[model samples]
Target: MLSILEKFDIFGVPIKLKTIKKQEQFKSSQSGVIAIIIMILSLAYFFYVISLWINGKLIPKVTTSQRMIDYTTYEWENSEISFTLYDIRSKINPFTKENNIIMPVLLEISGLIISAYPRLLFSTLQVDGDKNVITIDKGKLVLSQVDGSKEDDQEDIKQYFVFFTKCRQDWMEEGGYCADQQTIDDYFSTNHGLLFLSINLQQYNYETLEFDEIKKTQFFAFEEKSPFYSQVVLQKQQTTIDDGILFSNFKTFEVIKDYEVNTQAVSAKFAQDTVITVDNIQLEFESLGAFIFRIDNIQANETILMPKLGEVLAQIGSIVNIIMLLKILSNMINTAMLESTILHQIIEIYYPQFQHVQITKNFLGQIKQVHYKGVEIKLANFQHKYNQLLEIARTKFTFNNLIQEISRVQLVLINQIGIQNIKNIFKIEEDLKFFESDRLSNSNHQIQNLVSVLPEESPKKSEFERFELFNSEFPS
Candidate 1:
């Protein structure tokens, strides 16, 4: 077992267990403190690393990069835009003393007029004068027709406008509200009517096979002094996150609104290929008294969230390497000190004259020479004696010789008694009757002098006599 164990060397060189014990005891008072310090530091750093790893600090770092792309590249044809208007203006009814609010009655887009009705899908409408909401589904936009005939001229940019009006008296009467012209004028002028516009822009997500809506709310106020116009620019943004092995993609549309008030009537032509005039304040029955907006241009922003596994590994590996280096350095120092101490002890054991000798060491803490009785002895001489002692210590008594002797005795016993008789002898019980009779006889005798039974002169028997006596007992 010892021979097999000696063959296993972890550090390229096998060290004796005795040498390690000597190092532990040599200058133990000082070395113990240093060992304790090293142990504390190593354990602290080890636990610190374990805690960081447990807390996910060892995971890959996240990185993000953003860029812009053309609107044509984006899938805008499948996207939809929704508009929701809320009337927050207070209009007290003369009869019931309740508030009356007006909502959009018609939606005009590209010379086509469509009835304005609540087309909300997710939420209910609140019309208690607090949150009177009117939802309109605008559907999808035709970008190619709005951009123009020539693809190259699309860079010049054109806007598409949609108008919502609430001026019709019949539409107001249907809602059980006042249909008089004076009531309509007073609602617009005295109340300074405010409309909460919620624009929901939706983008199609190819990954989820669904549409994600991004909603923006703006407040538009109608005053007798000036007209308020809110211009909104729709921009598309896509984001991707690297989730370990796969990436998660999300698409969302962003609405950017620019509000301006024109004191005079402004003429803004917003159509596919024709122009239309816009008035500052619409008292006329044919004018759009509600909100007006146009889609200006489209811009795309792409952001990517990436994980840096290599950098994380490098940082963790660097810390582990520093700790391992410290451990290896400490082991090397201990090994060197152990070797020097072992050599000195071996030299003292071989030569009693060197017991009081002073050993000199170099800066590296290696034994350079030994000084004794005004004479200097080189470490090479001591090393030679140490090697001789090691050889003597390695010489062990072989168990093979003992095993051979046992085998010979077993063969002799087998030949004298036959294998079957040997087995029977082992199985037989001992006879205690002779032992009992002998004990009784000895008790009855009670010899006074114990020296009388001592032999005066005895003749030694030779090997032949002993063999004859053995043969007589066995008798083949």
Candidate 2:
């Protein structure tokens, strides 16, 4: 079984050759250097794989893609939005010389007044439109859309007109009088107050099963004289997250706000078009402080977390295979070096005259030929001779044959000399010589009788038979 295994020339399996002399098992410095280099490269490759795993490159990855959507037909049940107005009142005292006492600005959304001093006054408001309404429920604001709204047409969509005004009929009636000229001067002073509008949007979180709020705030400084109008476009965003652990996808809704203020100044006559009138009484306020919020478009983004364990393993295996190519090259170098050494030894042993022969090899270190004293021997011829020598050594120097030859030589000495004479010659004690001369004499007499019964002309004689015949003829 071992011999069968040795016959197999498997790569990377080292099988020691018993036929080759131990000293002739050749090694070269080039092979040793190549082996060291291969070891270093293998270590480097292992570390490289470890680094990729440690850096999260071998884990799941997130990818995102976005596309535009029509807001009219999209659902808004998973989202909530609200707006907050801040810093509308002046901090300076009205009685000071500067007299920078700006009155609190009121927020008019869908004809419902929201006071700045007390924050939001009305929790819900319904406008006289197709399906226009704003309501705050469960700490979140909801905007209702018209049923069966057209996708391409947005004329009937609910547009929230938020107006920041002062000195309205309700304000005057509450105070029981109008502001004096000094108070009016403070309202329009050089240090105009800044209004900050914060739009809070909440989206459902699938992982945590909760609502996550995102706030976008923008500040606008009220103009001292002319009024400007701003247009706010609220866009809807639908995001889908692929959870690897759960092996499922979750969707959430988000509202994004984009606004632009018209820098062109509007005259009082032109601003009167946007003024809110109650019982034919025009409200007194600046024209520049109004925002029209409308939901017009939607955006969809999908995030995918790709699990890549198999791919990472495949990548690592490919890299290892590439590194193993160097190991194959190292094995080839060692094999060539060993073969060249064996060839030189064979030539020196078989032909002593070629001891000083010049051996030639190719670029790959293969033994090509041996040249000595105008005679040349090719590699094939040298290998043939080496095989013949191996066959002869295997047949002649076997263990069993060597043992048999030693046994035969011992028998001949015992028969020729008596056991007692042999013991004295070898300095053996009397108890050590177990066999007696009578037993030996009886064995010789039986051998003589057996030889006499044999044919005179035998095709072949055994070594013992020939030895016994020679002894009988010479009367030894």
Candidate 3:
């Protein structure tokens, strides 16, 4: 009874004897954390639900029909299907007002990149990524025209995206909203394979005290009828990012499988200066970069359909001379016969007695009288010839006139050559422009180190060929 009473006894009857532990002894969490967490989880759930709904919508309905699709895959060199870049200024020092602000430069630039349609073949741009390398599996330049199908090819379509998806939950935990966009993957279906674009670390603007905004952007040309999908993602690279970038003013684009230009140039070189040579005249561009297509090795000799105008004209001139000479020789061979023989023959045939009956008038010593109409006698010039027939031959079949008509053909050929060469060069110029523009626009193609042919005439061609007015090649 005594022990029990002592345990239950009011021991601190004196106020000074009572005491409490320190406030720091108890552990607690920050304010509003639970609410924010709940909110975030709810949103995540909502997004998931929306995704499910979208999938549900895409589910095919019951149908019965014959359908065909070509399961095709293509490997394109340096086909940069997606790209993402950022300009960031983080508030590393909150007191300095240098908020870790991410300037999404690519967001603004996204709307400007026009998709360059893939070509039938491609030339690669060789580059050192410092960490990675790409080697080709095939190098043959064989191609037929693009699709003749009514529907456009899907893989050739052009699209772009710039995105940064982060754990809004994690960001909320860190008191931030943005995540760095670091990787991009292009899913071109089973036939086309997938293409991935990764940011080169060396290309990053790490100490971004300021941002160099990308202005004056435009669309790169693409084939007019193609279809493809695109995606962009922002990823972290030893850094934290905040905020998403917005894109403006982008239109859809299509691609072509077969595009025809009047002139095309392809360059190819052997691998590492091989021991044997197959051909030296053709420039090897296959080793340089991603080519939508490689123009085949054109046999210039085969394409040279025009002969030297001077040579052909000279031959024609010789033919004319020969014909003139032949006519003169024929006149000499029968000079007397053609004149007097016709008269004699005509007189004999018309009047048989003319051959025996002759009245002669001699010169000064003796009496001489010219033959009468019935006389079958020879004369220097025959007036009894077929004048109508000779006139017809001279008028309708003159060798000189025939030569004049033939000469027109040569002039026409020269004109045609001039016009055709002009057109060919112009066409080459135009295609070269497309190639250059495509090379520059392709993010994967490292064109910064190489020089490409210009859209206009080459420097030498412009200075020399343009002035060589009398060259046989140009055919004035």
Candidate 4:
């Protein structure tokens, strides 16, 4: 209530003290109860009106502000590891116009935290080319380890948030996993054009930073002509060597590859070798955790890499889920409004605080071509500008909790670029509360239909009203 009162001042003029005194004087009367009820209803109505106004009036005003591509859709991994995230943007099918998805993102993931030197982190597989084979590439290391001790292991994830994940959303809105036969095989490593982030990440900085000083550094955007290109990081497996057929990074954990062990292998210069090569035990314990998996060779004593604990669990779980999903799929079963990885297909969208809104994209898309006999609401009326409105809505209205790295990096970017001049009327807390209740995995979230709800006379009617001019102001 106090917070609500604080927000009312943003409307500019306050109610006079005389009115307040008069209202207090009438507090004990029978009419006061009715007045209070009226006041509450009015307040509620105001919020509803505001929601419509923001969607209707303000959204339409910002057209070209919307269509920016969101290549880096999701992120995971802690701040200590050296992670380079990669993504691919291409048509899923050359023949079909709509099989395109930006990147099949890994919205929800959990892996082991302990560092393994020279061992490949459990990674997302990348496409080799336009073809399906995955690739392994390189990038930078952020926030250098001060003591340089790879031994500093973190048992707990240092508070990372999961966003835009079907799994998380399913768990939240529907109150459990979507128990359809949609198995893991239909999902993981396939022709599905996935975006893989070799999440050796310790710091996930999706936002631009602002700084007090002119902190100079070489940085480039993801735009073309930008030197840094998004590269694919392949899942760790075998690689043939100059000498003979050798395993890449061997792990007995999540994966098993059969190979000949150089029984003469002295595993001491461990960095040079792949697996327990010397013909010793049947299988070597490459690493430790809850379970151990091994690769059996037709030949004896071949070495294999030990995979991390979390990867192993996720892999096995994936295999099980695939088997189950295949069975369900064969039955010609549909989940019937269950959770879906394919949210791009969900039409009847759930919107904020409005309840189970049966709004889907195709339904809305069809609504435009729709002609009404009773009322004169034609989607064609606002089709052109309204499309732009939705495009601008893609520019994520981020409300990042001021993490230290975020604060530092943001200060460098936002401050350096004079982003402070932007006067935001809404409180960070208030906007964050609204975002949490609205945009995320809330059961009520609707795919924001940013169609024009404002008249032509509105200030926001302009295409790019809210955003500042381009950084073309940079030194030439």
Model 2 agreement with the true structure over 386-429: per-residue lDDT tens digits: 46654654454567967887888777656655455555556423
Query: How close to the true structure is residue 300 of candidate 1, measured as C-alpha lDDT?
Result: 42
Write one digit per residue (lDDT tens) for candidate 4, span 51-102.
Answer: 5433432111111111221111122232211222232543222111122111
Winning candidate number (lDDT) = 2
Superposed Cα deviation of residue 224, candidate 2 (Å): 2.2
Better of 1 and 3 by lDDT: 1
Q: Which model, 1 or 2, shows the larger lDDT?
A: 2
Q: Give lDDT for model 3.
A: 0.29
lDDT of each: 0.43, 0.48, 0.29, 0.26
Model 1 agreement with the true structure over 1-476: per-residue lDDT tens digits = 98788678555654535434554234433355556766676677667655664454443333333444333322233223334333344534221112233334333334232223322121134434433344444343322353336465443222334434333334443334534667757765664455455555554333343446666556554443443334445544344434342334433434222223222333222211222233222223232333434343344443333234444455556776675566555666666665556555654554454566676767566568766555555567555654565454333123675577689877866765457655655544333436876656554333422222235332333422332211233222
- Return the TM-score for each candidate structure: 0.42, 0.45, 0.15, 0.13
Off by over 4 Å in 2: 1-160, 167-184, 191-221, 245-284, 315-325, 328-332, 335-339, 345-476
Model 1 ranges off by over 4 Å: 1-18, 21-101, 105-130, 136-138, 145-166, 170-186, 189-221, 244-298, 301-315, 322-476
* lDDT tens digits by residue: candidate 3, 1-476: 98888888876454342212343222223213433554565556546544543343212112222222332222333332322111122212111111221211111111122232211111123333221112232322222234444335433222222221211222132333333232111111112212223322111122341223221211221111232222222111111122111222222211111222121222223211221123323212212111122222111110111123343345445555544454443444444333333444444443454455353433221224334344433332222232333444354345686698678765664454455544444444232454766645653333321223344523343343232212332221
Error of 3 at 184 (Å): 24
Per-residue lDDT, model 2, residue 110, is 28
